[model samples]
Target: MPTAVPVAALDPTDPDAGAVAHYGDPAREQRLLDNAAGLVDRSHRGVLAIPGADRLGWLHSLTTQHLSDLAPMTGSELLVLSPHGHVEHHAVLTDDGDATWLDTGDAPGLLTFLERMRFLMRVEPAEVSADWALLSIVGPQTDEALIALGVGPLLPPDLLAVPDAKFATGSVPPRPTAVYSAAALQFGGWARRMPYGADLLVPRPAVPDVVEAAGVPLAGVWAFEAMRVAARRPRAGFETDHKTLPAEVGWTAPAVHLEKGCYRGQETIARVHHLGRPPRKLALLHLDGIATDELPARHTPVMLEGGERPVGFVGTAVRHYELGMIALAVVKQNLTPDSVLRVGLSTAAMDPEH
Candidate 1:
């Protein structure tokens, strides 16, 4: 992943300022993210641009979300599933008037899949990761921070737009095909609510200017991960694996549109939703004894107290400032919320939050 801007432009004393991890005081950065506002360089996230008239319709028939009527300047999320209904890839989707934007952790793989499925569709997909930069402005004052950076007006009207009742109409106005020029600043970029706050997609060359203008402390990936864990948000690789279904990780409502037209994994999703329950369900595990600093690593076995057999495994674990040692785990659906489990060497009780 490339650095958003020059390291010298940021605090030099904070060694990891331009790296993937934290800069200096991770705890202090986490506090700023929770209380005020902080900027995180997410340029590593994959970005793809899909242009042409058939973009929405083509993507609508391939992904789980209903994108055929996706309106201009609005956003939604979708999941690409295997034929048997397991989630293969996930993307955060939004569209300007002329083209659609797909953001994911695996841009190359997504681009390859889309290209292979193009057939005769008018859609043309191109990887634009090098051309754009993604930054997340999180916390209660996220909007204020963006305004201070002079990018507030670029955000869509409803930053928290989802694929639910609010956007049921699915009507989008026609947009002109124009290059992303200075005049396009009002609608050139896209912003959407994240688990921590909201993310802004901007031009790559302007990242340094934006960071300097924001004047807020920069946070590392560790702080972002902790906040995401606290929010109980399951990411693509950590909480989900190859055979993982959407319902297993609690992604059904927002990422899956059951009532929409037929898609690759629609049948399996519908069958599981209407007839049976997923084999596993997501849960929040509260580790016992906060005194110990050691936390269980990912994929550690989660077993029933005094039982010889393992029931589940940990996914994302973090030492949250407020929640202490908390982790998200995928456990057997049969296990009740009151079940006591053992994670690594520590005892854990399942929290009802998940």
Candidate 2:
């Protein structure tokens, strides 16, 4: 069950508090901003620590991100796929100096997968529930806020994972220095080990101020939707599933490590990329309607004019205060921008990225 934390407890001046009230709960939208601009206590996300001398080598073969050449203080987003190339788990990998830390959305599954794949490698995977907190801070000024926090320009335009501080002396260990996979390449977004998970969650005016100084809007889920649509970023669960492959989702965005040798799903991914074709494409849907607090049910059929066999489903919906409601959907590759699409009572303009 998801635990509820008081937003007022975070910080009275946090813009996140305003967003929470505007959307629903201030605590909920806290991490919507990129970097530390909107710090939400995201301890609920699972963090698994990979230890042992072969830690780097073991995970290198397991994940899509190349980790062998990974530099220190850097992180990469990776996906664990089924042998068929379908996404099984989405993760963020960071080398914290002594051990390669794999941050996955699945706490149990990640640990299980690692254990099952250990083979003869001299590495060990352990669950580190006591150590780190996983927070997804998003916002236009996210980088500025991280920089202000003493991290050097973390976040994609950089992908560096420089440490802001050691949360505790002996509380948690670090990843090994040598990189074992290509996924170790940096893209931006530093995953630091904060001492107490709760400190980063608490909203401090100082944190928001750093991003505000960058002159970017402090956004919540609404603004984030616009940004993702503009960037064509895919969200887990909403935009993908166990059956979804990186190729079908237009994962040209570094979500998959194409050059990384076989892991699970490597064969299917290769076949689809080389011989077969992507079945569907992830696209943005601009529908006409006022945004609502109650999200549309997942997998709700997205229809085209005449209610033809529904083209797709709502991947994610965000109420952009200014732009109204916008969503992402996976539709048949045959669908074109000119196609008139609909979902329930609303008509949508299918905007497929070229």
Candidate 3:
């Protein structure tokens, strides 16, 4: 098989590969978490460009997330799933009015996979991360900072601003420079990028800190794991594969379009959603009494108490400070939330909502 390389060498076949991020130093995990709660630079994530006459219609027929509703300075969660309903990728689309750009995990070869699938469609998929910068503004105070940055005036009102853009411009020490207009879903950080060929300049590191405060929550791989699981979000590699469908990974809500007519795997997706139930369901596993250092690694089978047959496998695990040890798992649909299962020495219950 031809190997694929992005930021790090990856095995697309492995379910846990995307979680093994190779950003900066390992200690930056806290920084990432802080950035989630504050402001920070994270341009390593990949960007995909979708163009072509049928680009909008083509993508609308493929993934979840409403495409027709997308407008400038706004975005939504986009998910691509397998025919059986397993998650292929979880992406966020930021529409700048020209093309729909996808922001997603820096998985190896993902860009190639996207481009290769763009055959006869009007949609064009290409990587533009190298040509632009990406950053995130998270945390409770994100809206406050957005107002100070003056992003409100710069963005269009058809969507939203973070109440207003936050900035403190001037020669003074607290001169604000960073800003992004907000519109929905509890206004947070902004992901900025110039056109692929444009010479957009990113401010110096010191500048972002001076404006947004350098206390960005730098979430490492583990922090991301925790946040994702808490959000009940299905993972790509772990919860799904080429044989998996979106519904199987708890992504049946908005990714697949039943009435949009056929695409590559539309037949299978429709049949499964209409006639058959998904084979596997995404679940949250809350470990009982497992210490942060004692969690099991990936591919750990979850064994039902009375039955020797394994019911599912652990997808992602994290020892959240407030939530304790938790993981996302692919379990038999027969399993109900709060059902108990064992994985080695740790015990977990299915999340009620999963």
Summarize candidate 1's per-residue lDDT along 239-320 as a digit string, tens digits.
8777789988878756777667789989898777765478998888889764466878677889998999889888888777
- Ten consecutive residues with minimal summed lDDT in candidate 1? 174-183
TM-score head-to-head 1 vs 3, winner: 1
Scored against the true structure, residue 340 in model 2 reaches a CA lDDT of 89
Q: What is the lDDT of candidate 3?
A: 0.54
- Candidate 2 yields a Cα-based lDDT of 0.56
Q: Global lDDT of each model?
A: 0.75, 0.56, 0.54
As a TM-score, model 2 comes out at 0.70
The CA lDDT at 146 in model 1 is: 60
Most accurate candidate by lDDT: 1
In model 2, which regions exceed 4 Å deviation? 1-37, 154-230, 275-277, 290-294, 352-354
lDDT of 3 by residue, 263-338 (tens): 4556666566655567777788888864334777676899997779988888777666566788888888899865
- Model 3, runs deviating above 4 Å: 1-36, 40-42, 51-54, 61-69, 81-86, 106-108, 117-124, 152-221, 275-277, 289-292
Instruction: Count backbone clashes in candidate 2.
Output: 37
